[model samples]
Target: MQKHSSAIWTGSLKDGGGSLTSQSGVLSATPYTFATRFEGQNGTNPEELIGAAHAGCYAMFLSALMSGAGVVPDRIEATSTISLDPTTEGSPTVTAAHLDVTVKAPTDEAAIRDFAEKAKAGCPISKLLKAEVSLALKIA
Candidate 1:
């Protein structure tokens, strides 16, 4: 059960460009550049892709967790905000990820919170990220 993605970058870092391709062609040759990553360009970036993946993965994981806990969620949405910031020594790094999650279920607040926390901990994408991650859960 191993998957892989590849990236090809040409030229220098600041002015270079790259394309990423995943095992599935759904993400083939996705373009990315310095401006797209650091600046607010209307192009794709690794961090943004990571955020999307994290959000989707967390949502699905939460759904399963809720079902396994004898609770079914009517709706589950997770947003992952990945922050890239400069380190103490001025090196750029992925500082943190803040997950904002909302769930609709016929469950107690305590159970919802517990399930949300467990989902955040058990999500594969969350496990892959080494940065600090925080979860905010809302039940309705």
Candidate 2:
């Protein structure tokens, strides 16, 4: 089970642009540029894509953990905030990924929190990232 994505870039780094395409075709030729990535211009960037992957993986892993424990969740909303340190010595570095999650379930808060912490550590994306990962869980 391997997935892949491709990108094509043209021109110099600061003045260049790129388009990304995923194997699933959900992001067919999506546009990204230096301004979009570093200047907070409108459009998508690698950090944003990574955050989406982290959040989605976290939610799905949490659901699986809940199912294993016989606790069904009505909702698991996760937001991954990726922090980039642009002033790093040579190049920008992703420093941290903080997950803000809200879980709606009919289970004990303690159980849900335990499962969430496990999911935070167990998710594949979480394991892939080298940045520090933190979670703030809310019961609803």
Q: Judging by TM-score against the true structure, name the best candidate.
A: 2
lDDT of 1 by residue, 31-88 (tens): 9999999889989998898999999999999999999978989999889999988454
Clashes of each: 0, 0
Maximum-lDDT candidate: 2
The superposed Cα distance between candidate 1 and the true structure at residue 58, in angstroms, equals 1.0
Regions of candidate 2 where Cα sits further than 4 Å from its true position: 131-140
RMSD of each predicted structure:
9.4, 9.4
Alpha-carbon RMSD, candidate 1: 9.4
The sequence of per-residue lDDT tens digits that candidate 2 reaches over residues 75-128 is 999999999998999999999999999999999999999999999999999998
Assess every candidate by TM-score. Answer: 0.87, 0.91
- Colliding residue pairs in candidate 2: none
